[model samples]
Target: MKKLMLMLVSAAALTAHSAMAKDTLTISVYSFAQDAYKKALYDPFEEICDCELVIETGNSVERMAKIEANAADPVIDMAVISSHDALSLAQKGLIAPLDISKLSNHAKLYPAAQDPIGNNMAVGYTFYASSIVYRDDLVKIKSWGDLLGKDLAGQVSLPNITGTQGPLTLMMLDKALNGGSGDFSSVIAKIGEDADDIVTFYSRSSELAQLMNQEEVIAAPLGRFAWSRFKNSPLSFAWAEPEEGQAGGMNVMIMTKGNGNEELAYKLMDYWLSTEVQTRIAEALIDSPANKDVVVSDEVADNLTYGADLINSLNILSPAEIIANRDAWVEQWNAEVIK
Candidate 1:
């Protein structure tokens, strides 16, 4: 009888342990800066929630595909993706509208960060400004039109039309040439006309950085997130404040539809967006804070897309506009820019 009682107690303890282990929240995130994220975010959240974070990291495209493939039964509880990507997922019914009340820090985010994708389907967590980064010693870039001017001629590079900064570059160049119209046909034709003048259409910021460091290219349009790579380079580089102003975009967080982990997901989202965490992430130079309450030193602010004055001044292209016209733009691009 004693032996049987001891066996039953051990079985019950094992079952309880298994039940506790089941408390987990799976998330999909960008592959970059995983170590920093683990230190500043993932580990702390795990400790606070007493739940494991099963992280799946990759580029936005692959992760979105996986989320779609498992739409009927979401493997990811929550994810962070570009606002346009979030809109696409929401359109496909792969993600659900957020319950803002669950996120205490929702009120703390910048107005643009709130309801960025509409219907509260997602919330912005970071903002990036895109502009020209040029070797001030070699050329002067005062306007977006200067990218194709006689001065930059063969020394400059333009972003490939397929990348995030591509449409932004087109938009600004259009503004410079035609009073800020949304139509990019003229821009594409103009770029084609000046194609030989450009060294190459770069697809990655890192690749662009390498070219710049090697003095193979002197100027290019780049997102502020990659500003550090050039700012710290041996060459003298400057972020351009063109007459047309800077183009900007946001990355957002979304909850998977019917993932049965709303409680835990919301918990993590709230914690991630809290002022403390935002400040930490900003200081680490990992992401620019969307929380308006976050404050950092001038030096840190210089390295990030910080402060309301600059954030408000940015001319952001709408996600709806991008989603609606990207296909047409791509077709035109392949025909004229690449061909």
Candidate 2:
């Protein structure tokens, strides 16, 4: 009778534990990463957990608005967002503080990328750096100064103020030509001088690509991701070595606050941070691996912005500062440059 009772209790606890292991995790990510994520992360993780994955894709503004709207009763478990967006949400207290110790692969991440903003608000996924894309056959633009030439009038493309490229390019050029190193306000003067030559400032990388393909533009500051789509083109990408170096942004993963799905979300975040996973996904997608320990094949490594010295030279901006000043910068941009 005692043996039977013990056996019955063990069986009941096992069933209860099995039931507690939720097999469904919904994640939000950029539309750009949708295909690669589905192929690499979603499929593999689902197979491992014997769970179902529901992926939602959108731009930063739309995704953030969704989270804010659903804060009280959150449906999204985990989100792959920009560090700027992460910082914005963190400031609003919409994201829960993550326990780094709980992550199975925390040690695999780049030391600087672990708690990217220093407040443990978000974890860096990958970084995007800006460079000059010019037609080698048609023009000679090796640095920021070449873009300012009157010969390229009506042929230059630029980033819209709302976009990361716009602000980063502005800062990069300012640090290059003007005496200033960090403050981007000085670069606007250079842009203002070449304003007449500037074509429409693009809000999307697609638009910038189109401009390049159509021969409506000669040179512009573009991200490393854009290079993948333009690999076969006659366009040449030159990493401009400015005094302050290249400017870039880090994409991060965020966990929403007060969500009942913290356990699953935490698990997914850990898996995403795993060096093996990062190496696998980043190589296939041409996105820079966020995990410092991740080692990729030579071909994929060539496609990415890599090498320790190069990465170290990258003057990456603080996502927190960018978000805090985003509105004001946009306003000022419109008032002065965009106008």
Indicate the residue-level lDDT of 295 in model 2.
79
* Model 1 clashing residue pairs (backbone): none
Considering summed lDDT, which 10 consecutive residues are worst modelled in model 2? 235-244
Tell me the TM-score of each prediction against the true structure.
Answer: 0.88, 0.84
Lowest summed lDDT across 10 adjacent residues in model 1 is found at: 28-37
lDDT (CA) per prediction: 0.90, 0.75
Please write out the lDDT profile of model 1 over residues 254-336, one tens digit for every residue.
99999999999999999999999999999989889999999999999988899899899898888888888888988988888
For residue 334, what is the lDDT in candidate 1? Answer: 86
lDDT of 2: 0.75
Cα error of candidate 1 at position 105, Å = 0.7
After the best TM-score superposition of candidate 2, give how far the Cα of residue 177 lies from its true spot, in angstroms: 2.8
* Top lDDT hit: 1
